[model samples]
Target: MSAEIAPQPLLQVNNIEVVYDHVILVLKGVSLQVNHGSIVALLGANGAGKSTTLKAISNLLRAERGDVTKGSITFEGRQIGKSDAPQLVRRGIIQVMEGRRCFEHLSVEEDLMTGAYTRRDGRAAIKQDLEMVFNYFPRLTTRKSTKTGYISGGEQQMVAIGRALMARPKLMLLDEPSMGLAPQLVEEIFQIIVRLNREENVSILLAEQNVNRALKVADFAYILENGRVVLDGDAETIRKNEDVREFYLGLTEIGKKSYRDVKHYRRRKRWLA
Candidate 1:
């Protein structure tokens, strides 16, 4: 007998409209899909409903104040829009929310254990998973017993991502993972995400403002503007699109070529000098 093939499309978000108080519409009609073992990016500026879309998928929408008014979110071929956040975790869909929401009072290791609250695995397996996280983020292991509030921001971000991993998710919703990090640290975090996608085969739906970096890593990308998906295509195609460059990239027709030529000129000037 042959080994069974894993199912495709770990998560799918189709035409989701999120509204606040039945008056304000944040996401007009956002549709996105993430295949198994691929990295996808949702690129948009602030207030573009990127985070709201993530909340809708994770079923963390504030029901009394905000909610998904229409459309469906499916995880592993099952509808999950109405499911609660904890139920989503049990379904192997987890979100590493924006702002690196860590338990400041809890120790690093303790915080990670919170993710395993729904796990039915044995304690020994949980322990081994903890060690695996330690290997991926060595700093977390060094500060395992330290309170999360005392750790550096980069370390805290690692703790947040590690905590999500502890749940053994098939798909991760990463909201602004590069937010508030130093330039070097942002690069470091992106590399780690790439590694996670490749090594663990974990699908990722990344909401990011750092287009230059996010497009480099994502296989597919969607560009949202004012609550609508204005552009959707393969990463490389979007990267090279003239319209995307002019509008979203903040570079005009001639401006795009000027950037390239300027770099060439600087390199030549250095060689001559």
Candidate 2:
């Protein structure tokens, strides 16, 4: 008889619930998993418990008067809810939060170095890692000495991502990396994430409101509505689904056209008049 093999999950959240001040319940029973070297997208509307899930995993839910009332979050086959943020970082699970919360007063290089605080490795190794981060984000290297507050929003976002990379994470929890950025910048950031997953083999658990673009890049996807996973499947399948198209992606049968078409139509109407 062949030995039965157990499927290994890099991170797992089974029936987790979080509440704020014992009054407002945020996450009802959210659950998902990320395997090795795969991108999983958690898609939903605003306040749909996407960020809440990331916070729950990182033990940062406390700041918002929140606590996980039920269930467990395991990372690398070990339960981690009791571990502090620094401990979690040491375990190689890092989160680039919703806001690109770099220290405004600090230089860009200094902000990235903060992620390496948990490391006790030799200075040469640290320097090498720093160089690697810069290689991935050369724009940051050019402005390494500048205060983070003065950089563009997109650059600050890069600093946030680079800082997380400095931790040498086995898994990355990214919350809304494309938010509030221009269309060009959003594309740039998504490309960087795709490269990170493909080139570096970094397992990513991405919680994003930009459903269309996320589904395009993710290997697998989970749709969270009202704190429950209403849909789960391969990314391409979900992208083609009618329900997903209407609710999340907002893609209509007419198809998406560039903004230039609308302007051209307006000009034609004025000329006809």
Candidate 3:
């Protein structure tokens, strides 16, 4: 019998470096992979270059005067280095950026419709997808006709995710989906994300600060510090790691200590050494 060949990655980022305004380097030789139909979490603190990495993949860095000056990013065997944001969207790659940016003036439904602007598939399919989004996010159904600005922060986040779903993405680069929301709302949103990955087969590259929650949902995880991937492994392994438990998950043999305190208390982590 022939050996079964493993499937190629849905998205591959190889040794990429990002710089802002051609001067300030943000990501230093960062690299990772997202296999087809898998959820990969990128966990890190604020300003750890997680968002920058996502922007590079979705080709949205240009708007912020940032550029991928080294290495490459490819989606399904095609290089996307020079692709524009809209062009990437048309190719089934969409990014739900940090801050849950919404068309504040538009109704919830209208905000979602904007996500399908790249599609030429006509209104029937679009309408069907919109209903599917509502199914995943029942709360969105209640606020469909309400202006997005009028909704709560959690609802706006749902609108953002629903809008991305309307794009029917093959790969979704989600940056900080749990930011500034109540714990219950965060859990609700992540449940939907898991459903999207398992049932819809949409591959996800999630950048998150909530380590405990991210690991619970992710198949694989990468930990970043100061723009570099410090450690990476399967979710189970990462969850059990001492450094991860102490630094990210707020667990310690002695007692719970802040990450800043831990950083200064120890000489340096083995990964950094």
Candidate 4:
């Protein structure tokens, strides 16, 4: 009998360090991988270098005066050294930023159309993609004519994701898609994300603060603290970890505690030793 071959990663970040404005060192020896057709979560508190990691992969750090000072990043078997962000997008890697950025003045449909800028496909294909985005986010169809700024926060978030979808990405770098939305909306978005992963076969690298939700949807996960990867494992293993349960999930044998208190308690975890 023949042995099974392990598949290569769709994206790889190896021991990368990021620095800002030539002085502020941010990411410290961060490394992770996203395999084809899988959802990998990057979990951390605010300022934990989650977003910076995504930027490093997409090569967006240059615009922010940040540079990868060490290590390497590879995508689809090619090294991405000093690659341009737009070129990355053209290569089917797209990033949906943290804030759900939208063109306030542009109509909802127009905002989505911007995602297709890199494509050389015809108008018919673009129209088909627009309908596909609307199918995933039915609310966007209803607000197609509205100015993006006039829509609800949840709707704005949908627009952001829909816009990224318009790019026809093979790999999506999603940063904090759950932030600032209602619990229901967050769940809704994550369901759609899972559908996109399973149904559309798109690979995902997600940076998220909502540990519980992210773990539920992700295949593999990495936990970051103070700009470094402190722990990582398969989702089930991570969820069962005592420290993760206490610090991130806000769950303990006793009850849920404030995250502020949890942050202080994390210093004593064996993983940090």
lDDT of 1 at 43: 94
TM-score of 4: 0.93
lDDT of each: 0.86, 0.86, 0.90, 0.90
Local accuracy of candidate 1 as per-residue lDDT tens digits, 1-273: 001233557778899999998899998899998888888899988998898988888877884478899899888888887789898899888999999999999999999999888999989988998998898898677898999999999998999999999999989999999999999989888989989888887789999998888999998899887777878888999999876665567766674466677668535633542
lDDT of 2 by residue, 104-204 (tens): 99999999999888988878888899998898888888899999999999999999999998888889999999988888998999999989988887889
Give the CA lDDT, 0 to 100, for residue 192 in model 2. Answer: 91
Give the lowest summed-lDDT range of ten residues in model 4.
1-10
The Cα error of candidate 3 at residue 243, in Å, is 0.7
Clashes of each: 0, 0, 0, 0
C-alpha lDDT of candidate 4 relative to the true structure: 0.90
Alpha carbon lDDT at 147, candidate 2: 99
**How do the residues 34-129 of candidate 3 rate in per-residue lDDT, one tens digit apiece?**
888888999988898899999999988999999999999888989989889999999999999999999999999999999999999989999999
Q: Give residue 157's error in model 1 in angstroms.
A: 0.7
Q: Write candidate 4's Cα lDDT for 92-155 as tens digits.
A: 8999999999999999999999999999989999999999999999888889999999999999
Which residue runs does candidate 4 get wrong by more than 4 Å? 1-6, 254-265, 268-273
Q: Which pairs clash (backbone N, Cα, C closer than 3 Å) in model 3? A: none
